[model samples]
Target: MRTWIRGLVLATLLLPAFPACGQGGDGTRPSPSIERPSVPSASRRLTLDEAQAWHGRHPRLLLAADDVAALRARRATQPYDRIAEMLLRRADEHMALAPADVGKAALAGPDPMPHVLQRLAMAGLLTGQRDYSRKAIAMLAALGEQGYPRRDRSVAGAGDLAVGLALAYDWTYEFMTAAEQRTIQRQLAALATEIEASMSPDGGTFGKLAAQEGMAGHHAVALGGGGLGLMALALRGEVNYLQSNAWQTTAEACLRAYYRDAFGSDGAGIEGFELTLRALGAALPCTIAMRRMDGVDLASATALGSVPAWAAYELLPGPSTLPAGESGGGLGSQDAMALMFAACPDNAAHAWLYDVTHGSRGRASFGRAAAGDASFAGPGAGDVMTLLAYPGERADAGPPALPLGKQFPSAGLAYFRSGWGDPAGDAVVAFRCLPRPHLGRWHLDVNQFTFHACGWGWAIDSGPGWEAADGEPTLTPTVGVAAHNLFQMDGREAAAPCGRTLAFVDDKAGWGLVVGDGSHAMGVTTFRRYLAVGKRDGRPRYVVVIDEIDPAPAGQAANGPQNPATAGEPPVHQYRHFLHTGAGNRVDLSGRVATLTTPDGGTGQFAVVSPPEATLKVAEIRTHAMGTHPRIEAQHATAGRFYFVAVLVPRAAGDERPIAVRPEGRPGPAIAFRVTADGVTDRVCVLTTPEARPPNGFGKARHRLQLSRGDLTQSLLFDLEEPGHDAPSAPDSAPGATPTPAP
Candidate 1:
């Protein structure tokens, strides 16, 4: 394939120019004088004969003739009417502004010209407004003439310019003159050449790359494949360049690789929430265009089938997501959701995500001025793609029917919630222990977790590591071990390691647990974290966290002298457990208990039950540009193995429920605790040894857990040799069945 493409490129480059199609050999009918527009020196203008031979249909990229007619027929309908009005208003706004100078250096804010051009073109197509089309053509001419000098700044910038030009050209094709079409084709050809160069092995904006690896990252997949590929599709038959076929083929390959590598099998983006939306913004549109134009169903070949569910799970109580990687938390774009619905119209979850995040009557409208207000739905409300991809009408099923907890094993992230759709009543927890290789925007935050309840982010991540203030970079104290809720050994940051999930069990009756092996992350032989959430009366009540650490392997004396600096003395490592709270939250420490109070008057009690001699303190840490926030530090030193058992309980503003925590009797190398809240007492026991047959009630087991409350008891067995075990049925419960709800 490579050889054939290379031959085609070489053949085309060596070919001579031909006369106009209608002109005879003796030049009976003279061709119209071709006026070449001022463009970059490297640009090649297609001759009149070449432009005349290129065959293409009008409005072929995103909309067909029949589809455009349907949109016109539905212009007075419910959703379409609202969306059409928004587009017309935006197009009017675009008419008042001048075309951007593409030759200037890139600015700090996002270039709005692309979206502005898209809106103008779409409005003209839907309303048959000559004014809108003419305005869009003028902008298109300016873009083609100036040739977007900043397109080489980043793949994203290049993609934006390519897509803007592609959409304006394709949608407004019928309104453009022969000369305008010729000029636009030359600019598109030049842009395609630039994009191909960036993906080459030689250093470019994207740096060195293999063909497959070039499309592996989310940015490349989004901007390179989806963005630039859309241009190739729009220009495939219209351009004389043979490299157009190679670009299209590469774009399709990028679609497949994006699903295979960029996102997990469970449809979770590795870079977290913000970039996920940005990538899908292009990828989904490209997928829709391919299906519409070529009858190819690329969405079926990828993890897009599960993306709606993943998006639903990532949404927290404040309608925001966790700052997992480089993201600042917010709801995903409505344009992406609309595209997801277009790809999977039969999927109720996708339909619901679209309906719930819709511009007018969705949760996105909360805390905003009014229904049709621009800020209510963010910038996506004004996007033209949302209108094109909108599925007419469907039932909006709430998320209650979906599972309360979901785990993306490929991405090594887990999300658990108590209920759905009730911001004030729901409790959410996000856990990360990525076993896969960490690269490109991923943080060294393995075994980290965040907590949210009562409409407040109780435990939070430190957000992105880098921030710029007034054009100068400012380094924050939040990075690596300093920014996460994990333990550090001997006051030294451990090397980033691949953390693994040992077991996961969700009863769907408000009881669930996830176990992770993070020994390498802690720089120890054994460091396992057991995290669980409990609900009482269909509401979230408490969360339990138990950490077990051992510096030596099994059958070796952990207390033996190992450090050269302390000869003949028992080895001891100072361990510190850290927990950061949300901004403006107050933390008070008393004995081993730390109480957190949110500005909304919600309260959370954090109690450390193990390591009797441990000390707890609260100090302020600067978390990027989010300002100073309190972080709880728990310190303990041990010569051998030890445990850190803690319980967190979240209470609503006025719901004064007494909470108590007591340490239970340990059975061998294990820790047990009993937590009582809301008139229910639950006891939990976790085994820490590699293998044990202690005479205690746990019996013969390793990596075992036993929980009992009232007449119900649950036991889970974890096998280290084989991970990914679902929670096993308790002795009193049916196998492979959900636990019975408490009366």
Candidate 2:
């Protein structure tokens, strides 16, 4: 009882009301009281009569679980380091020591531990055995007494206690005589009175909907708590217990706020992935319960990503793209949790539970073993547990593509899907560039990237820990936009620059973009495109194109004698390009394209080719030095060197892109290419001008001649003109033209 109380307090105090519901009582329906229905817990899998009935109608209905032995066994063998094992051991010992009292269940972390006990209780009930119920109830009572403790708030104790009580009510409801129900009622009645002390105007009082510690780590907890609270009531089934006016008020407040304000109108999870999963997983059950009693449907709640996080985790494997860690932008243990979550019921909600099972240690500690011993291996095995799932349908039409918010930040990443399912395929493909290693920030490099496919990360970003020979960047910045291959300016490095200057600015439109201002140029990448298709003509191709323009050149004062190597007047105009590759096999840069051909003849390319029949024409065609952030130079003018990525990706039919021809005789899927003709050139451009003379009588007349203007629209117009022709009023193109390939 003590433990149960503690757990409830901890969970509630950790996070207050649900974010899915808004705070005010607009036209939205009133929130309902939390209630639970008795559910059986049995060793053998059995569907409840109610569950079957719901599934018959909804088809996508997800029933709650009551298999304690199975869940316990699965949880037991999960790989745990010393700290995690100690906590589990302590929980088990405490449960054994006070088997008669339900208060000891608080032995585990406040928010998560009680859920474990609730699961055990539900399983015991389904087995029609009093022994399991007795043990479970005692654990809850013990937990209640101890009261979940945290350095922060004590109300969270109420949350864990709530879950333990709900599970007890849900699993033991049928067997409990009226007197037994009273015993449990007496325990919970006292806690409900204090809930208001913790409620915030936004439903975040006591930290529930609030960013607990911060928006980045465990942001999901805010949303996760609401689902747990609802689960407590649903499993309990005691109308008297759920009908408490205090509990009902909290539920109403939380629900209204969640839908109205917490999530965006378009469903974006501003708190990022952690909260997104937590909210959705808990919501599945809450939505179901609410609709059954009060006619409220939260199924349409939007904060969900287009493809769902688990699906992406099962499919892609790159370090988080977000600034948290270098391993890729997603939650660290997402891979393992995504796999484990499949069996829980609703695929998306199941994914959230999978991660939560890792407990206080965080998802990085989650492992395949936690998913049970069924051996989840096969084609798309660990990737997506679609065996009992529904395919997503686009609201508009066509195959369901992930929404832009979901797709872009999560786009073009390669991750290792290492758990169950087919052993033959081990790799996942995300066709976007990775940030180069030496860049200071974690911003995706404009042109650098990573590729995953065929059970391996073939074309990949060199991780950021290399040590330079002379205390400089051994590789590109592990941070910053220049680490990626979107584009560059006057050869200046983005993030940190030497010869030139570049930086990334927010996009007024819904996307994130890069901005560059160099010694001789200023340019902005206006748009970007990522394309992927089955190997066309037997070639596997993924292409990314960035559209950029430099509307003006730098003033002479900014460029004048910055250094000896740069002493000569800057070039009138310059365009630079960068092409990175996943397959290091064989690469070539020619005309307006960069191509990588696997040893088996499969290919991927970067190119600026005519896209069917559009009125726009491409002109100036040439290849120059590899474009990238500044680093040590072999030659005074040359900085970074380019090389084709080496032997990777096997040669196999149905896995390669089909070959095709272009106007320049270039092969299919250009990895990196550009053309600058008379109008709207596709090549990356860099421009420079002398600084302006100070206002004074001694200023030289030639200082006025240093002015130059760079125009992006003009550059595009230039590309439309015929090739082999020079700009109408400019000098010939400058040196360093070694047409290389993108590897």
Candidate 1: tens digits of C-alpha lDDT, residues 28-116: 65322211111111113334454345466768777776688877877788666766777787679778756564334123224355666
**Alpha carbon lDDT of residue 67, candidate 1?**
81
Worst 10 residues of 2 by lDDT: 4-13
Best lDDT among the predictions, by candidate number = 1
Tens digits of per-residue lDDT, candidate 2, 164-260, equal 4554555554545566556655555545444433543344443354322111112223233443445434433333432343344454434434433
TM-score of 2: 0.43
Question: Residue pairs in steric clash, candidate 1?
Answer: none
